[model samples]
Target: MGENLHEIWLKDALVFLFAAGVLVPLMRRVGIPSVLGFLLAGLALGPFGMGALAERWPLLEHLTFADPVAAEPFAELGVLFLLFLLGTELSFEKLWSLRRMVFGAGGLQAMASVIAITAIVALVGAESHAALAIGLALALSSTAIVMQTLTEEKRAAGPVGRAALSVLLFQDMLVAPILILIGFLAQGQEANLFGALLEALVQGGVAVAVILLFGRFVLKDAFRMAARAGGRDFLMGLTLLVIVGGAVFTAAAGLSLALGAFLAGLLLGETEFKHQAEVDLEPFKGLLLGLFFMTVGIGLDLATIWSELGLVVAGLVMLLAVKAIIATVACRAFGVAAGHAIETAFLLAPASEFAFVVVTTATAVNVLDAPTATLVTGIAGLSMLLTPAMAHFGRRLAASVDKRAAGEAVAETFPDLRGHVVIAGFGRVGRTIARILDAEDADIVALERNPVIVARERKAGRKVYLGDASRPEILAQAGVAGASMFIVTVDDAKDAAAMVHAVRRMRSDLPVLARAQDAEHASLLYEAEAEFVIPDAVEAGLQLAGRALAEFGYSNEVLKDRIAVERSVEYQRAAAPPA
Candidate 1:
């Protein structure tokens, strides 16, 4: 029996690899998001799909997952990596800066969602406890799906992305208490709900304190020691250890494992090796996340949906509407723009993986019946399946709103502007340039795709506007024709190149400057008619070498001359075409 189980595992591994390696790439070529691709693949291969006929068509057995639960452990690791990577992108200081949105918007969104959902469920004839359980289960959004979507769309660092993340963070904090409440409901009137909740919160607080303390004290030193061990393998192993160790610790404390991983990432992000950690774990995160999506797909019961098609569809629609409306209002109250608030609402409207856990527990304790649990789980799964599409639509809708707003503001903006800098992309690099230019009191008009950034920067009294720079109309609107210089500081290589090309088409004599990730990207930007292309990697190397020379007591002038010579040589080499 053990051998048989091992064989089944091997087949399942093959199936997972097939989806990640083959199906995903094909989906990408057709412009489908990888998250959806994995879901469809999982649906096609799970027991309810191809595996249901394995006995009649034995060959199908090797191509499908016989048991959905088998992949749950690895699926969970995917969630850990997702949260950990997100944490690595943030610092405690940045998190603190978002405290208002996190606590205010996040708290309101959660509370409102639960109350609204519970009332609706009760109105539909569910018992009070059962309705409450359903509300708690379905109120939250899928962290994995939403984060992955934002990351894929390059909006993870923007206002909407950060806003979504803040709400999700608060939701993570609520998981333990929600579970406790469900347990209390199961225990009937004899159980002390407040006491159980308070106890869980206390335990959770202790667990967080311990994790933070260890991270603050030991995390940096451990990473430093690993780096000093003279091999990347050591660093990689240590990273995995930290992720898994933190995850296990939190799980033992009756909290979410992903929360522990997120804390570990937050600590590691504060260390110098944060970038290396991200680079090492990226491949692992992608594959594991794909598997996680597949597990969600597997949990989807098509038969149940088909049997109760009308009810399931109505429930899904109602879930999205209530959550989206509440989330939008909550975000809007916290200063998010109307367009971006709507986008965030759509991004977070879907039910999350947490619903399965809540419903399953409620069923086990007799608070919810098996059919109700299955239906809720199915709704959650189907909602996740729709997340990518919803997010895409939200972006488009937001862009439309932003374009109209920009048009209305255009006549009063950039009036008779000439010899001013026209900057594309309002990200970190673009903002840095804006700061330096602002110091010089240079005339500048910046165009950005993210309305949230535009709103925030405008509130800070900068001339940032919402418009995609890749379009000729946006460039014209930004006064690029009369600009002294056009700067393309966007992080996306393709977008940067496109912006340069668009500028060159309209203003052939305009001096265009662009940012590139590497020499290859520099060459591409140059080919796109950018007169000046700064390769980040090459410049970083030059700066580090110059700093090293200074540390070695070299004269400042000598270091300067040496770095200049190297820079010229590197740029010239990069400019040349392939041999």
Candidate 2:
């Protein structure tokens, strides 16, 4: 029996791995988000899909998830890893910096969404408790889905991303109290609801404090020791240990496991080993998160949805509309820009995985009927599947709004900006160059894709515009034609090269300086007609060598000559035709 059980598990694992490793990539190549691809894969391979026909054709069993619920625990781990990875990207300081938004915007979004949803459900004739329960469940958005989409779009650090994350963070915090409230409702006035909620709040607070303090004080030292003692293998093990250990600790306190993992990520993000941890654990995060998305698809009972098609559609539409309006209002009230608020609203309007948990618990405790729970779960699952499409649409809409505003500003500001420096990307390298030019009283125009950076820089009186510099229109609008120099400091190799190509098409003789990832990228930029290309690897080596010579007290002239010779040799090698 044990051997057979292992075989069943292995079969399911094999199917999922194939989806993650093969099917997802194919979807990505054609412009589909991996999250949606995994969802479709799960739906097709699930019991409702091919599994329903498996008994008649026994061979089909090997390809389908005969027992989808068996994968739920692993799916939950996927959520933890997703949140943990997101946490690593965000430091405690950055999180702290957003405290006002986290609490203000996040809190308002959740409360308003719940109230609006609850009213809608109640008006549709659900009992007060059932309506409240449904409202609470759907009030939250899927952190896994939203964060994954933002990460894929490279917007996780932008204003819209930050706004959505703020709301999601508060939703995670509400998990404990919301579950407690459901239990109180289940007791039918036999228990004190306020007392129960307060107790839960206190317990959660204590648990969080302990985890944060321990992580703040000991996590860095522990990671450093692991690196010193065990190298990469040990560091990887330690990362898993920390993530799982933190998750378990929080789960023990009746809090969300993802919360603990997020805390662990925040703590470790502050340590110097952050980049290494990110590289080491990214594969695990991706595979597991894919599994989680697939399970969501599996849970989508197509038959049930079809049977209650009208009601399901109504519920899904109502849930999305109500939440979107409320979230948008909440964000705007907190001073988020109209574009960002709208994007965040759409991204978060979908119901979360917590809805399934809440509905299941409510049904089990008799607070909600099984039929209602099933319907709610179906709606939630369908909503999650729509997340990727909604996010994509929201991003495009937001970009359009931002670009329109940028266009108006350019018309007003760029008429006489001649001989200026047009810098692509307002990131570290671009900013440094802009500062040097500013110090010299030179005119400058900068273009960047990140809304948050544009907002911040614009507030600080910089001439930063929100648009991708790789596009010829954005380049032309930025006055690249009239500028004396064009600098490409965008991090993505493809984007940097595209900027060079775009500029060359417009002004072949423009002095274009670009930052490249390595020798090959430098060669590509040089071929793209960039007048100057600085490969990071080559520059770092030259700087290291220069420091060494300086430390040895070499004469200034000798050091300069040695650096010049090395730079010339490296540049020539980089520009040479590939062998």
Candidate 3:
């Protein structure tokens, strides 16, 4: 039995990886977002597809997902990583800055969505408790999809993205109470639901306080100790420990595991280790998040969807309409721009992965019947599957509005920047590059779209303009046409690629030294005509190897020559087709 389980796991991993490795790039190349690709992959792996075949076809047994339930853990981790990354982006200072949006827009969106959906469900003759459970489950948007999309598109740190995130954060925080409410609604359960709620509150509060205290004190020092040990493995293990430990702790408190992981990230974001931690966890986050989306696909039932087509269609349309209305108004009230509010609404209208957990748990607790739970879950799944397209349409619709509102129509001027360096994005990496160049008295012009960041940097006397780096008009305004060099330092791969192409078109001979996220991204940038690409992973590896070799008594010249040879070989290997 153990050997069979192991074989099944191995086979499933290979299939999932193969799908991601092939389908993701294809989707990305064709301008379809990864969220949809993952969903499609999951559908192919599900019982209605491959799993059904595995039962009858001997030849294809090893290529199918034998047990869909086994993928759930990986899917859950993907969500935890999303929350963790979200938490890391939010420092206490940033959180304080967005307090109004968090409490105001977030609060209103959740309440309004729940109330509107509940009323609609009740009007359809459902029980009040079941209606409430269904409403709560469907009201939430897919955080994993939305966050991944926003982050990849360079919108997560933008106003619309932040507003959407604030609402999602509130939804995450509400999971515990909803679970307790489900317990109360449970049919034949004599358990003291309110008592259990109180118990949860007490335990949760205690657990949170302990985690905060420990992270604020012991964890930082522990991270330092781990770093002092000078082993990436140790640091990586500690990172996993922190994230998983928080998840376990939160689950123990009757809250969703994602809540605790978010808390841990929030705490760790305050530490110096945040950047390295992010680097180490990023690959896992991407792969696991893809797996999470695929599991979402597995949850869907094609036959049920076909049989209840009208109900499914109606449920999805109603949910989207209600959520968009609620979220748009909420965002506006919280001071988001009109176009941004609409974009935020669309980005968050799809039902979340948590909806599955909610519906399943509710059915198990007798708060909802199995059929009702399954139907609602189906609605949630379909809504999620359509999210990428909805987001794309919303973004296009808002583009003109955002442009007119921001007034990019009028011609713009820049400081004397003929032969100056063009720095796109004013985030951490860009800032570091600016500092280095500034110390050497290298003239630089930076392009950034975040109004707040631009305003703050301008106040600090930096030559930063409020503009999207991917736009030709913006690039022209920033004097990229005659700039001596272009440094594409944007953290987003898609944006970086666009920036590279834009720069290459304007100045084919100019050196465009771009920061590639990883090897794959480096290849994309290279294809985009970037003059030089330095992948972050490759650079880090070189640095570590150089230091280790020097410590092992190699002469400076020998180390330099050896490292250069390694760099040359790596680039050559990268240029070669895979065997």
Best by lDDT: 1
Q: Give Cα distance to truth, residue 507, candidate 3, Å.
A: 22
- The residue-by-residue lDDT of candidate 1 on 499-519, one tens digit each, is 888999998999998889999
The positional error of residue 145 in candidate 1, measured at the CA in angstroms, is 1.8
Per-residue lDDT of 1-579 in model 3, one digit per residue for the tens? 999899888888888888789977787898778889989878877787677677578767666677778888888898898889888888878877877888788889988999999999999999998999998888878778998989888879887778887888777767788777776777446767777778888888887788888888888999999999998899989988999999899788877788789889999999898999899889999999999999889888877888889998999999998898899999988778677788889989889888988888888887888777778988999899989888887887777675554345213546346889988888888889999999989988888755556668878988877677777777787787678988988777898999888877777898988887777777778888887777888888998999999999999999999999999987765544434
Residue 1 lDDT (model 2): 91
What TM-score, to 2 decimals, does candidate 2 have?
0.85
Best by TM-score: 2
Candidate 1 Cα misplacement greater than 4 A, ranges? 224-234, 414-442, 452-461, 468-579
What digit string (tens of lDDT, one per residue) describes model 2 on residues 1-579?
998888888988899888888888998899888889999999989998888889899999888985677888888888888888889889877898888788998999899888988899999899999999999999999999999888877888778888888889988888888888888788887788888778778888888899899888888888889878966998988888999999888877778888899999988888898889888778888888898999999888899899999999999999988888888888988888777888999999999989998998888788899888989999999999999888877768877887776665555457346899998889889899988889899988988876667778999999988777777777777887788999999878887888898899999888999998889988888888888889999999999999999999999899999999999999998887556
> 1 or 2, which is superior by lDDT?
1
The predicted structure with the larger TM-score, 1 or 2, is 2
Error of 2 at 373 (Å): 1.9
Rank order (by TM-score, best first)? 2, 1, 3
* lDDT, candidates in the order shown: 0.89, 0.87, 0.83
Q: Give per-model TM-scores.
A: 0.83, 0.85, 0.72
